[model samples]
Target: MPASRTERLLNLLIALLNTKYGLRRSELRETVYRDVSGNDSSFGRMFERDKADLRHFGFDVETVTDLGWSEDDPATTRYRIGKESNRLPEVELSPGEWTVILLASQLWERAALGTAAANALRKLQASSRLTDVELPVGVQPRIKPAGRAFDDLVAAMHAQHPVSFSYLAGSTGKDEQRTVEPWGLGSRFGQWYLAGYDRIRQAPRYFRLSRLTSAVTVLAKENYAPPKHFNIRAELDRLPELPLLTAHVDVRAGRLLGLRQRALAGTEGHTHTPDAGYDRLDVQYRDVEVLAEELASYGPDAMAVAPGELIAAVTRRLRAAADFCAAPVPAIAFHDQPRAGNVRKRTSEDQLKRMLQLVPFLVHNQGLHIQDVAERFGVSREELEEDLQILICSGLPEGYPDDLLDIQWEDDHVYITQDLDLKRPVRFTVEEACALLTGLETLNGLPELAEGGALESVTLKLMAAAGEEGLRAGSLAGPAVGPADRATLDLVRQAVSSRSQLHLVYLSPQGDRVSERDVDPLRLYSLDNTWYFEAYCHSAQGLRNFRLDRVQELQPNGNPATAALEPNEGFPAKLFTPNDDDTIVTVQLTRQGTGLADDYYAERTSELPDGGLLAEIRFGNTAWLPMFVAQHGGSVRILEPRELADQSRAWIEASLASYGG
Candidate 1:
């Protein structure tokens, strides 16, 4: 018996799978788990845990009890992994289905779901052949299920359990603890939402991920199953739209560039101040609280001059920020959560998973070079050798040479002499099915990619293969970021396909400046709900990214692109590209605003005594510092760069003074 837990699990799995009649507990303890030096009770607990672990890896461990005329017989129970129930059935995917699968797998970048999608793809790849499908370049569409809430919510949904979390009610502007049975998670209007039954309110409610004010607590004791045939898209679509209201805001001159872009033309009223000048504009808003949050984030630079509700809301938040900043530091700092599990334990789990796929892959592609095999699995040659050694030692308990899996890699080429019975990859679990299928569903909205209804066809086929459990995919969804302007998207795609330059009249968000430029199209991609394309601007003579919606005019220049195309292979995960000369500003984040640390790519962070986080983040310039502070309300406070901090404080104070604060 091996000392390694991973090896023991592997041997146990082989023995269970190969057994004709299931192996009894006593038989398993004697042959497969001979290393168990503890008492009978300890062995029973360990066996139970191992069985649960195997189930976690998507393998069904079937239990058969020898009943004497239907009477109970726990002592005669046996365990085995039934081949028919465990192995993945033959899956035949069309060329189009394969293409969408490839695209869907690439959609999740660095998010937790990315791993599940990748594993699902690998199993499908191992089971079926792939057709050559060229994915769109520069058009990298990605979905980031951000925050710990998303991770916890997904787990809860998978477990069919209720969850309790602190959520800020938008209408009342207060945090409330709500117990909810999460039914579905999806994106609508550029934000992630959890659709669930609120137990406290006794009604179905939709929760925006951002408004969650605390960590989600999964109520495992209270389990639930979503209503049959509940469609998340339809539910989200049924949400009512808020009435739009016009806000009269006064912004300091040459500031609040983002707000300025949304301002109505010819409505700018000018006012002079001792320190600066102000321009008043009419801005359309759907929610007072949402608008107030934005205005308050701008600190003293922008003021909600009209609409009593907006003004009151903004003032209250500013006062809160003031009070929060002046509060005493906490006496103790929070301990950090472990970033990962034990190194050896994780490595063993990874190896076990990789070996499960390796057996089937090697069976299909025999006598491949050892190095090639290692490269295919993204492992070093030495690591591959270690895995191969483990495989040769794994098999039945008969102790015959034929009982063990036979392999040879001495000649730099590898071959499986006798694969006991791991010829097919395991079936997809509910989580894996959800990750891939939900991603494909999001792509269905894009008519261009759904050519000939390939996306739909593929989805149906994969769902059928995954069985009834796969339908639970409707519980999770991505934001539907379809082409806002098909005409514009079509032209951009054509220009890139033809390798031609495009002349465009574009709006620059920096200072509300409109300009004409010729650009060589590089890639077209999307973040959340907006589409953007990266290109080489002939006018700027450098690389730039342009939002599709901001293009007022676009036409091909009818000339070949002079600049070589260097399409970025991966999505630009960062919104603000840092440079060597970027300014490093330090700030303190209240518990609610700690998420900003990841959002802004904080270079360094430390726990503050007051249950807050101190983060050092880089900015290209300090022009937006005041706006940043105001945007987060009182949740973030600038700590360093005394000059900037003073300016932000003065800005807030000035705005508060206008409301007689």
Candidate 2:
């Protein structure tokens, strides 16, 4: 492996950051470059390259001449990061804006967090408020998430390198080796896809990360230029939504009824046979294979009446499943489990991004307390110091010290003197923009916003700030919260802010029950594009979250005087707090289930040699464990937490029994 020039420069930077009087060249060689010190000429060349590197990274390194130190010795020179040019000015951010920024950071799961998202968050948090902010709940907007090979792909793109990987072709369902020059990444329907020039196919193609069957390996150092007009968003939209095919089935009131209700309003018809009891069922599907599996679970109760292929597909699947169940299989011991593995390693992208943001902040806002800065970034004071040390050599080219970034500090207070390229602030990535725009839309639909106010202007300005690309984010299609939901949101916001009570009818998530109750509204928020009304429920006498969509009716009533609890003082914080106690579960996945590993198991998953996934997941609670495992079917096996296996198995049995399969 080659020497880490990034590390060598970082060492030199730390030495410079730690002292008022910068160290001499002789001192740097003895300390930072000690292992491989060269003669004077070679060392000089190395120092020049290091300076140029720093300058290229936007550091402003300045050298001061020591003209008359002593008559007996030749005058020497010293270097230091100046305090004025390098620090960012104090940034202005609203509490609402800060919370939205925080939410935007959640667009990706674990593996994706370390890239651009992490960096932007570090910068936003450095100067933004940490608390006393009202957060809009559950409004997660994901765009081009960095899934499994996200980091590697980004590195290859940045370094201008080609990458090779095993891809499972969507049409063929076969793994094929591919070499591609990645152009850009995009997202549609909440899944990530990579657009690249496929060398093997000799065409530009988009690959879904979920379908990738192997680790991405960067090929030898050869760069390919992207087409001048290449645009990820445009190409992503060009993927075209396939037309939904209409399928006629025979079924009556049951799970099929629920599916019918979810379909487009006009696409329903029935045979209306009283004696047979099976109604002629009609449903539309974009993917016949997936739809067929779902229909097969309904057994003889549901049958595809027309579209011979659809009937054949469903029959084929049902027969295959029956054959599997009929065959005998050996049972394994209950305790058979793989040994625990190390936690997933976080990518270095986050650290690099933080430094970029930190530089502008230090330049603009000088003399900030180190501890305070650390708290803003959710990092320890020691970690902050270490980051600063690494930033010392973060400038232009190594030998080109003319534009070096100058970092300065006096004990607890930090100062930036000269920052060449670090002064300009970082821009929001496309994903961040999508999330922020979606959050703004939620706020835009409020009744207060409809009446023409500050929010209206904010909506227009924010969307405008997003540019064309923001408007083009396909996953953000259609209004997330329509006028009806917004109207409810407005009333709920009023109740929360005014400390009033609300009388409303709410349907349970299972849709089996509905009841009217009085609630003291606490917060009106959205989660994952779904609006939720959280409040102190008088009926339950505790804090509860109600999905706004399930809320059938709402009427505001009572005043602050009628409130059961005082504002900010007696508010039950625990009522809405999520549990932190964890239960660890180990699971082994077949090749088919490996794709979801990057999504749900990014922090705890390890890749198996057979392109499967070895995941040890930690659940905050096991309430959803059974259902979650059941969703993936037999391809995913729960290996640990013996109780989980039993529960999941029981749930699967019950589900099958309910379907009469």
Task: State which candidate has the highest lDDT.
Answer: 1
| Candidate 1 wrong stretches, greater than 4 Å | 1-3, 69-74, 137-139, 265-276, 287-297, 306-351, 365-393, 405-418, 510-516, 539-541, 570-661
lDDT tens per residue, model 2, 142-256 = 3333334765675676455899998867576557999999877654543467888999999988887655656788875688776664657667667876477787776655434
How well is each residue in 1-661 modelled by candidate 1, as lDDT tens digits?
2327778888889888888789888899988889769998899899988898788777899888785522134468888998878777777787767877887876764455766777787788778855677676544677767555787788899889999998878777778999999998888766688999999999999998767767688898888878997778788888777677888888889876668888988664435332348878789987676788788876666778778778877877888777765666443322443222111113577788888888887887788899998876757798899999989988887579998999898789888878888888888878889888888887876676766677888887788878866878888878876877878988998888889999999987544468999999877887666788888899988677889999989999899888985864344434555566888788888755665676677766677655557777788768668767866677787777778887777777776886678
Worst 10 residues of 1 by lDDT: 337-346
TM-score of each: 0.83, 0.60
| Error of model 1, residue 303, in angstroms | 2.3
Lowest lDDT sum, 10 consecutive residues, model 2, at 567-576
RMSD per prediction, one decimal? 5.0, 9.4
lDDT (CA) per prediction: 0.77, 0.57
